[model samples]
Target: MSSTKNENCYIIKLGREASLSERANELEAAAASGNCRKLLQLIRATGSKKSDVSETICEDDGMPVTNSHRCLERWTELFEGQFN
Candidate 1:
């Protein structure tokens, strides 16, 4: 599929996403790269941000995270896809 950016896209200031979004993305990427230390930092930093992380994952289709098991499964799937 051809990539296209929506011209009408605009940020919603009414309801901003939680800060954990960035950390989650970083952690996921680091995990894919097999960075154990980064992954641990991510888990530790995720303390009070768990809810935001879960909500973001649930809402994003690219990151299918329904349950804890599914999250790990999906992460492994993505990691394997990247390596192989």
Candidate 2:
């Protein structure tokens, strides 16, 4: 981490992972924009969630599939119930 022009909001440096792909770059761009809705749309349109994992994800018959609107809705509902 290095401070610019003195201090008070120093930039934290991250060691780059050399294997980053094009899709990873796009996702990073969307994430860096700080607009959650746009990132969500990109993720939804591309179905990027859980797509890179090597593990097999077996969804139950009634469970919401990953990267879908239903999964997002289910997550929101679950969190609302938990915190409310």
Candidate 3:
């Protein structure tokens, strides 16, 4: 039934959330201990390949922005303003 499918989806989501939380805790501990290799491993494990953006761009104020989400958000705002 649809309800059973929804319950299965919810359980899967919860399992993923728990796994991410555990990885985050491990990452925090690694960072506190200055374990760069373990930190990078945890980061890579927690991050998705599809979300990886290696390109660096500049913000509107000329500050360098290397984060993909921030770059996308800035560009979206700029384009939205031009259209509106």
Task: Enumerate residue pairs that collide in model 1.
Answer: none
Please, what are the lDDT tens digits per residue for candidate 2 over residues 1-84? Answer: 354543533322222233235557777888998878878876786674555644233244665366666666666776787999
Where in model 2 is the C-alpha error above 4 Å? 1-20, 48-84
Q: What TM-score does prediction 2 earn?
A: 0.29
Per-residue lDDT, model 1, residue 47, is: 61
Comparing 1 with 3 on lDDT, the higher-scoring candidate is: 3
Task: Report the lDDT tens digits of candidate 3 across residue range 1-84.
Answer: 999999999999999999888888999999999999999998887777786656666887889877878888988887898999
For candidate 3, the per-residue lDDT at 82 reads 98
Span of ten consecutive residues with least summed lDDT in model 1: 1-10
Q: Give Cα-based local distance difference scores for all models.
A: 0.65, 0.60, 0.87
Using lDDT, give the best candidate's number.
Answer: 3
Give the 10-residue window scoring lowest on summed lDDT in candidate 2: 10-19
Which structure is stronger by lDDT: 1 or 2? 1
Q: List candidate 3 stretches off by more than 4 Å.
A: 50-84
Q: Could you tell me the TM-score of candidate 3?
A: 0.54
1-84: candidate 1 lDDT, tens digit per residue: 223333223233322344556777888899999999989987887765545444324323665566877777776776787999
lDDT of 3: 0.87
Model 2: which residue pairs collide? none
Instruction: Highest TM-score: give the candidate number.
Output: 3
Clashing pairs in 3: none
TM-score (C-alpha, index-matched) for candidate 1:
0.35
